[model samples]
Target: MARNNWIAVASAQHARRGCAIPERGYMQVCHGKRAPLQRVAPGDRVAYYAPTVTMGGKDTLQKFVSIGLVKEGSPYPFDMGGGFVPFRRDVAYVPAQETPIAPLLDMFDFVEDRSRWGYKFRLGLFKVSDADMRRIAQAMQVDLALLQFESLLF
Candidate 1:
């Protein structure tokens, strides 16, 4: 299959585990031709994490997944919403390294806290690939899009 790009959106925070747990937040990626998906309610139990890309922007992708959206023991092969679908193991993730997405990362107002990393502003939009999409979906459960945001975080 042709390589695909991925993007993810978050609406909540999960820093309970401290630095060891690099934040596992729900996120989605572009699945065909759709818009970014976001959580509906505030108390929604979704996932959160520090996502990363493979190489660079050879391809593009957009994802929508936030904290308090999905549950812990949820099943796989389940639809995350939008056109994106995730496998069973695609539940949560803890980014290993700080992704070299300088273009996008530079735009954010990040605050260096005691933990890993924190962004003062939203991450906005990003790009990824299908292989990366599959990998991200497997790591962080959420939907993706190539169009626009279906909703906003705040």
Candidate 2:
């Protein structure tokens, strides 16, 4: 499958737990509601962005915290056994070095204004251009070669 690059925003706390469990990799969003997640496909490349500095007693430094490869699955609701079910997609995730988005703001087309780079993140899950994805992967010090991208003739 061709890998489509994606960015998903999560709170530091949730991002921490999601990265910790890579085997059963799941990116939960919208309290179990599915919309954008349903559009995600297997083999897609996902970069997780944490907007806050700390979560669940862990300090994330407010940065892009993890990267993952989507596994073979569709959006499914997992019952946490406490009436807490969140829609999620299976992913093979790896914790990444904290890369603050501030430095790379100018490199992304999604960020029109340097001071408001975060405005785009309001949409929890969204597609990112291959260039932006590569830049983000570079900033996180992760290898983007692992993801296979569809060729663009233009």
Worst 10 residues of 1 by lDDT: 10-19
Q: Pick the candidate with the highest lDDT.
A: 2
The residue-by-residue lDDT of candidate 2 on 1-154, one tens digit each, is 4568889888767877887866776787655678888888988888888887554346545588888888887888788887787788888875567689878887786777887777878888888987888778778876555555334321
Writing each residue's lDDT as its tens digit, candidate 1 over 1-154 gives 1222333332222122222332433333232112333321222222233332221333322222322223233333446588656432122333332222323332323324424333422443343333433343333433423111233331
Give the residue spans of candidate 2 off by over 4 A.
54-60, 149-154
Off by over 4 Å in 1: 1-5, 9-24, 28-35, 38-91, 103-127, 131-154
lDDT against the true structure, each candidate: 0.31, 0.77
TM per candidate comes to: 0.22, 0.85
Residue 93: error of model 2 in Å?
Answer: 1.3
Give the 10-residue window scoring lowest on summed lDDT in candidate 2.
145-154
Please state the error at residue 88 of candidate 2 in Å: 0.9
